[model samples]
Target: MKGAERIEIDRRYCKGCMLCQYVCKYEVFEVGQERSALDYLMPRAAKLENCRVCRLCESHCPDMALVVVAKKKGKGKE
Candidate 1:
């Protein structure tokens, strides 16, 4: 697999559960100081390159606020 392109945490729906941090095996997420729309502290993608696109965080998120977009393969060449 090409791995992850980006990791998105929808602030509008996110409840700052930190499930993404708990589930990320690569330690991609960090404890963020920024508060969301709901006034809950959010998690930030601190080490994006370390992610393997496992989607464990996305599935574990209770609010369905996390989205991990995988990098597409074979655009033209390697």
Candidate 2:
């Protein structure tokens, strides 16, 4: 099954434009009260299991803070 291991958002570089949340189809991101290093409110990965690893959020991030880590597929043992 193809899935995302996790989504890493670099808070230091995040501008909290919410482009990630806006572009996400699976509703993986949500507005968070936590502030980033830049003092901007960051988007939280609320529903990680909903992520399809489509990378729309990563591509849409103007600040390039979003990174979607895909789950590695395991080889079948004979």
Candidate 3:
């Protein structure tokens, strides 16, 4: 799981809605004080180490504020 992709949240579009955190079975997200452009608290990737590269948050975000990027492996070892 160490080399898996990470999930990122866009603070600008976030509305303090914890749907992303709620939908994550791996508990990869948490509420943070970072205010959004809309003046609302936002959630953050607090437990990225537990993420399994699942795109549940991306598909569940109503504001389209979540992004799950698949980390690219360097070099040509594949």
Candidate 4:
């Protein structure tokens, strides 16, 4: 199965619309208490392991604040 390396949320531009959370099928995000520079509630990557590298959250982000980094591919058993 594909896995994600990390999920990044740019706090500076995030409007906290939470479209990423709504689009995510893996439930990788949660409502966080932390506020962004825009003074909106930011979502936290609570369940990193749940992410399947689908990039749904990234595409759904209106502010383009969410970034999903997929695990690097390795050349093995070639």
> Quick one: best TM-score, which candidate?
2
Ordering by lDDT? 2, 4, 1, 3
Between 1 and 4, whose TM-score is larger?
Answer: 4
For model 3, residues 12-74, the per-residue Cα lDDT tens digits are 788888998999998888888789999988887887878777788889999999888877767
For residue 78, model 2's alpha carbon misses the true position, in angstroms, by 16
Task: Give lDDT: candidate 2, residue 39.
Answer: 96
The lDDT per prediction is: 0.89, 0.90, 0.81, 0.89
The residue-by-residue lDDT of candidate 1 on 1-78, one tens digit each, is 447889888889889989889988889999898888999999999998898887899999999998999888877845
TM-score of 3: 0.81
lDDT string for model 4 (1-78, tens) is 677898899999899888888999989989999999999999998999999988989998888898889888777721
Off by over 4 Å in 3: 1-5, 74-78
Q: How many backbone clashes does candidate 3 have?
A: 0
Q: By how many angstroms RMSD does model 3 differ from the true structure?
A: 2.5
Query: Tell me, what's the RMSD of every candidate?
Result: 1.8, 2.3, 2.5, 2.0
Supply candidate 4's per-residue lDDT for 27: 94
lDDT of 1 at 70: 86
Better of 3 and 4 by TM-score: 4
Which pairs of residues collide in model 1?
A: none
Clashing pairs in 3: none
User: How many clashing pairs per prediction, in order?
Assistant: 0, 0, 0, 0
